[model samples]
Target: MNDQDITLSRRRLLGSVGAAGATGLALGGATGALAHSAAQEEAPTALRSVGATAVPFHGRHQAGITTPLQAHAHLAAFDLAPGAGRKEAAALLRRWSRTAGELMEGRPAEDDTAVGRDAGPCSLTVTFGFGRGFFGRTGLRDRMPEALAPLPRFTADALDPDRSDGDLWIQIGADDGLVAFQALRALQQQAGDAARLRWQMTGFNRTPGATAQPMSQRNLMGQVDGTNNPKPSEPDFDERIFVPGDGSPAWMAHGSYAVVRRIRMLLDPWERLPRGQQEKVIGRRKGDGAPLTGGTETTPVDLEKRGKDGTVVIPANAHVRVSAPETNGGAAMLRRSFSYHDGFREDGAPDAGLLFVAWQADPLRGFVPVQRKLDSGDALSAFIRHEASALFAVPGGPGAGEYVGERLLDG
Candidate 1:
């Protein structure tokens, strides 16, 4: 399109440039507006700012780990195709990386699906990781981090093997659903003959800018989750959440371990409980997530506090009480979770719950200890079932001109 036509097209696409929800510019009359439009013919197209906010694909670490939770996400795992060894894996990663770089910048890949062509980048991110089976498949087991060890069985687990682990994992997130879906589709196509899809899960959170004020998101059970998530500002945040460069296995220096779980809440039984009973089960206020012991949401829990009846406030078996770091030798995980609903079950009950994704320097110290405690006797466990689980070693981000896992795959 010519300069004049391009400008006019943008103006119309953005609705007269000054109309409500447009560019917010107000060029009063047609004469004045035409003059302004002509002067700005060469100016970049303005189609609202949502799509313009891009997250760079290259960095010291993958984007989704510490990145803010997005509105939409797709978590999928793949197994290397038969006879597809290290060489094939390396080539696949190269193609995947290039496509990811383009998509994250709101640009189309060479074989773009056009699903999100009209939208901006919307803060898209694609994170890659290696599952335990991946190492065996590619004959790189020696390079896999010890932290990727299999999790011990839990009492509350009803895991489905088919939906559990795979050779490769991908996490795609974006503020826009179409953008997220487009990225997922592109990556799947790129896998081609090198890998085959194992399992996939879709999830979502409250949309950014949807709430009048920022707050922790609520799950389908209507409870505020992630109130005590570790922040990057904390003194021990990096030490606790990411692998140290000095640690063994050079390729995983800046990486982290991810514990993926599909926890299904028994909503029928849970919703039957009274509000007061539910609060006791979680040991938090139903409305605002404040500890039953007292004070606001951010206030530290007073485990010592007793009620008028001399019973401990914040019930002994409450979910928060059992999972608290203090109760588990300072164990904690950086939870970046999303709620998922995969329609209804054959029994007609809603099939939904949290796609619990937690990151830590070591799963043994972070997820294992805490989860073991919960499995033993957590009151919340009665209303939730662990349906699927997987652990992955997510290496540091690839440098410029390098694809993810290039070090290990190409070594």
Candidate 2:
């Protein structure tokens, strides 16, 4: 379409954007009047500034690990087709990587679908990783990182075997739904005979510019989540989240380990609690996510502060207290998570919660320790169920002429 036509199309799309019960930029004209049709034709799209944004496929590390959360996401796993081995796996990675590289640039892949043909890149990212089963299936068991070992069972776990583990994992994210879906569909088609889909989950976060200003996102439970995530500026941020350049296994050098969990939040019971009680469960003000111990959201939590009644301000079993780094020997994980809702269950409770993807140099020092402590006494556990889990070794990003996992696959 020509520039004028494109501008007019977007104006119409924006005019009808808002839905009764939707998140993100649902409505453009809630109170203010919208531009007349004639004027709209001369105006630009609201998303025009951010639409052309594109994340480079090649980098020191994969895009999604530390990349800011996108508006839409698709998390999927795949098992190698029967008889597929190292050579097949390597070939599949090449094909998948090529398609991923192209799609992230807002271009159609070799096996193209027109689903997102008219959309911009939208800052699309496609990340690839390998689960524990991947090494064995490809005759590379000796090279599997210890960090990819099975996660120890937790008290809150009610895992589904079918959806838990896979030989391969892919995380696709984008500011626009269609862009994310385009990557997911293209990669799945590229897998062809080498890998078969195991389990897939679609998720979303508040769309970019959905609010007056960017801030920590609220989960389905209506709580500000991930308030204390490790910032990239911290001196130890890279060491905590990604392996050292000279780290073990050689291939995992710049890579990070990802612990993927599908935690289902039981909203019925949680919402029933008085607002006061709900805040106690998380130990943070629901409005701004500040600790009950006080200050803004970024204020350091004072775990030792007590009330006049001789009780701790932040409850002993509060989720934040039990999961804090200070209490867990400095263990921390970069929680790049997305909220998921799969309608309702047979019992009628909304089957919605978090697609919790935590990244760390090693699970032994990251997710495992903190999760163990949470299992022991986290009050939030009472209202959530751990439904699925998997650990993937995400290798460093590919360079010119290189594909993901190339070092290990060819080692």
Candidate 3:
């Protein structure tokens, strides 16, 4: 019969089965079934999903100048009360999005395309997402809420000591350093003492042609990075995003996992290196992301090939070598790293580098393991140092709510 008829038939069969059982047994069985159903419903999705949008420059700012508009990233964790008002929080987000766009000359809206002037008045666009601990049939689900059915997927996570929890992360971008601080102040007012927020700022000159390239391409090293990242409009987006399961609930199908790293790059040492040596270290041309072994950026790397007297051409411990296909464990993470040019030394020298952001399905298999392997003395490590690191559990699907440890504040 038709799908609706089949559903009705199944309901009738269940009803008949219940009627045939004794009253006491039926009641006990129903309660047990409900508990089982809740447990199944609460399980996190198998794959992480992501949705992202770019805010471009369209106003009086230097279209290509690399040193005017400063960029910064911020993150915070919330210890939400058991009955905290999520609707009010979501309402604040909606209001903030509108106010931020207005403050930036109407450029913060999802579809707004107007670019603002450099070093001029600007607004901020705030993107939101759910973490792994937020999903499922917990009481928090009924309390936490979202304005829309499918929330925008932006990279934001709190600092988790272990890799088991996700933090409520909010990233703010602006033209002026003061503006960034102002945005954070406003967020704190709305969130109150219910949540704790920690933020880091990275200010740099906005480069021309930035809008033409993907977010993952621009790095502090003045190079187009992460050319190997999955393209946004590719057909594989669904596969990379949603978990595989016919019985999976509709709400959790479109969520993604997020990972954040506060990496400090030693630019002086790197810039000191001869351009040729730099190229060799990265295993690719600095100007273009082409492999040293030859071919375009998209070409598969020839990692197995030997150079000269049978030594590996790319080298076993090179940044690209360790991060490449040879040691990635056959898993790919969509990276959207941002160059942060702040935290200068006492002598007025540059000290900051990149806020490395990556998204994938499984943190253990996808990011953690790969990073652990790379930490074993890769060439890139010479120029870069991991000053701070944390893992966040990003939840997937609809009706997914705030993180698990969030209710600790209520206690």
Candidate 4:
């Protein structure tokens, strides 16, 4: 593989964002609303150069972590088959890495199904990671990064073990629906007998160049998400997201940790509340994502502002207030989530919610503290349930002629 394979073009990215608003999905950035319907349109025409855009596969960091959210995604995990270990895992990664590189560049495999043969790259990305048990399964326990610690149980957790973690994880995203599906199917085949599928969740976001400009990335509950997301330009963004070379685990240098959760929104009950009460719950103006205290979307939330009744304008238990970095010792995570709808349930309610994927240098400093705060009293907790959870040590992007995880598996 070429070292130059993974760099994203800044000019191309900017063009995707129209002046008026953003496309529906801009992952790893400010939140925007995802429009869901009774059915997903296969490939709803092309927009600008969406189909021609390509995200390089080889870089210092994995692509999907900071790459803009694609319109469609497939999040799945796999457990190693019996007797599979380091040797087998390495070979699997080799095949996966090669195929991922080709597919991401809009090339197809020999066994390809031709699902997106003419769709071009569509900004596709296929990211790989290792869960806690992955080390033990591969006999690389000693090389495992301590950052893969188990997540503490939260009050709102009603976790289903079957749908949670796995020995390995894969996140596939693309601007085009068919291209995303093609990547998912291609990678699953590459797993071969070395790994068995555990759980899979399909998600979608607003397509690039969808709106006149970029609009809000709204969730199923109809709220603007990602208002306070940390930007790459932030001085401490890389320090907080990617592990430096001086990090403890030698193999994980430049890598980051990921916390994946399937949070189901209680939409029926939430929709019952009037829009005003809903805004009060989140402490933001639903229309523009501005703080209730006033100003635009980027306005600083007034935590100290009080109403006429001497109560804080943003409720003490409001999600925005509770999850604020100031309130949680400056703990922050780059949240790149995709909205999911698994159709209606047997109970006649929609099984729709978010596939929340958060990345940080260390879980202890990023997701843990903030989530702990939310666990205690984030008003949004009332409307969401943590159904599945996982923690993975997503190693840094591979160097030239190397596959993902080459350092750990070969070191």
Candidate 5:
């Protein structure tokens, strides 16, 4: 490669090394040698191109939700420290917003962490949200939307309270793992004495340009997931996913509700099922994610179609059938999720699943009804476990010189 290409390759190598360090991956002789050789060669376009991809922190809505999914992400929740109330929370958010905006533009925060310097912004996005309990902690209960109420217990939930909810939530995403980690670490440091981490979850999706061309991402279960997610191009997308300004609480205008779930896939059982049986469970083709009785991934599912034997083509209890908006009074949510693999469990099974994050204007109409149906008898529920859950009200993107939740926290 030429001199310029070599410089880019070296940056890619450094980025890889930073990722290894972030993940606590020890670099031995063979790995180090391999990394050196790989660095000499041209890096993938995705790696080299990502450093130039930047998402603005100030917008009509937060960046992470609508921005295409990044390859790496960190989801964290924090509880306010004792004696830290609305004033403290507001100041913290201000600090965070300033830091997020700077970092997202490939600039270091006032307190620099060199973790992401060599890397471009990689479309870094930092989104903030408030949990239901946050209102009580900040003495702003009257500002809390009824939609922010705790989700009703689901039959399939084996929730860990310790990792469930908190007063504040932060979502950091970037194509590069180190960049994402750096942002997470910086935010945690910025929290100072105002808040302490309650729980955090790391997740990932396919890197942009990893495949030959763009396509939908697949979850751990190997299904092309999120095919039905609402698109910005859709006429009613905003209405369906964002709270209207006319809603009761003025502070929440243009905001959205996020339902986050740590779902553990029962891989052993799920993998053992025959492909046909697996298709029956999800009601979609494994290879292309098309509806079983459909033409393409986006083709409307014909739930009524049946086989010669007079059985439903997409099983009655199949996931797609149960969760389809049509079956739920046209309810919809914009699903943007990541796959997580946290190594093996004590029982030797893989502890991995989808980090399901769905955004909607209202959870009661968006997630609750659909999930309740799934709880009753969605075929796919048998192969997955809901281990932790949280719901947060994510306000609209901050305007210039403002931080997220400024209205509720300062008004």
Candidate 6:
């Protein structure tokens, strides 16, 4: 049949099957239609995957402040097999990258890509960071140096041998809840028989009141969340995010450190509190995320003095008190957090909280110290609990098709 006639027939067939199944029906006839159908069939399943990487864009707070989306973050620990060297790991990673690209572009696999299993909708963005022991080894010695790598200030003392001392992290995002599990499955499959590569996954989501705005907007809790956050798209971001000096390796510079915390919110009890009491605890209004001692949402908080009656306006132990710039001598960390509303608990109640994510040049000096300070019996502790946490050293973008940290790890 002529091209037009074939097209007409295919359209008729597709119409008969309805849009949902039309592609499959059309594939049964014309060669071109068959090819298209195969392509559609090969497309990755609609699954959730994790996305873990350093913050790249400027003005991140704007997106966090404006969006209503919630984020859930989790951390998984893994190790590599003894004989599976870097080359094997690289091969696996390259395959993963290929699959991820296809999935992102809506392509599916014709056969199982890894573990003899077919590709699916869920994919992950896996990023690597070097540890002291990784650089100490001969296989990677020439590639990495202690001075050039991220200090192992955040890792736990009980190290996993099979897993590289180096860090591998993944961030998965989706409109569906299954994405996280799917991404984990993919990672497990890719690891294969190798027991040396150990990993941990920490999940976080945006808060209920979180908007995709910058500083001064209120999140679901009615208190302004990031009023004190550093402004992106400015020269300061360059200085803060990028490591200074020609002495540093080219790959190492321009990257920032990532600190992740899986905080559990006590929503039920938090909601039970009277609105005024809640406002006092958060030091802001719930609807707007504004400060209790308010001006506009973006207005800087006045933590210097007490209220009219001499009682502390913003309580000394409030979250804002610990995280605020004024109280901490202008200490800062880039926060790109999200709220999460996972499925209900066994009791049929929601298990929800914030996926607290932050980035900085120095985790020890920036995030850990700040977190330690905030942990000091703050008013925010009343409604939030830190269930899981981890720190990752994220490299900057790659140049000319090279992935970030490719050279340092000999990938």
Q: Which ten residues in a row are the worst by lDDT in model 5?
A: 21-30
State the lDDT of candidate 5 residue by residue for 1-411, as single tens digits: 686885675466545544432232121223433443354455445455455556678877888888878899999999999999999999999999998987886666888686776676777899999998889989998888999888999988999999898999998988899889999999999999999999999999998767885679999889989988888899999999999878758888888999999999999999999999999999999998899997988888998999999998989899999998988888999999989999999999999998989999999999999898889989998899999999999998898888899988888
lDDT of each: 0.84, 0.85, 0.47, 0.83, 0.85, 0.49
* lDDT by residue (tens digit), candidate 3, 1-411: 786885564344333323322332122223323432333325322110000111222211111111122344344444333444454344444444444443333222333222321222222333334443333323355433232122222122223344222335554555445545555556555555444444444434343223664333547776657776665477764355333333133232333445666667778888889988887788777766777778877676688878879887787776777886447666567665567665688876586787766665445545766676676757777777665454443323212233212222131
RMSD, every candidate, angstroms: 6.6, 6.7, 18.6, 7.9, 7.6, 10.2
Per-residue CA lDDT of candidate 1, range 229-252, in tens?
A: 888899999988998888768898
TM-score (C-alpha, index-matched) for candidate 6: 0.64
The local distance difference test score of model 6 is 0.49
Rank all candidate structures by their lDDT, best first, as comma-separated numbers. 2, 5, 1, 4, 6, 3
- Summing lDDT over every window of 10 consecutive residues in candidate 6, give the lowest-scoring window: 48-57
Q: Would you give me the overall lDDT of model 3?
A: 0.47
Task: Report the number of the highest-TM-score candidate.
Answer: 2
* Model 2 lDDT per residue over 289-359, tens place: 89999999889889999999999999999999999999999999999999999999999999999999999
What global local distance difference test value does model 4 have? Answer: 0.83
What TM-score goes with each of the models?
A: 0.89, 0.90, 0.58, 0.89, 0.89, 0.64
| Candidate 4 residue lDDT tens string, 214-238 | 7558788888888788889999999
Model 6, runs deviating above 4 Å: 1-77, 101-166, 174-188, 194-224, 244-250, 341-351
Q: Which clashing pairs does model 1 show?
A: 51-120
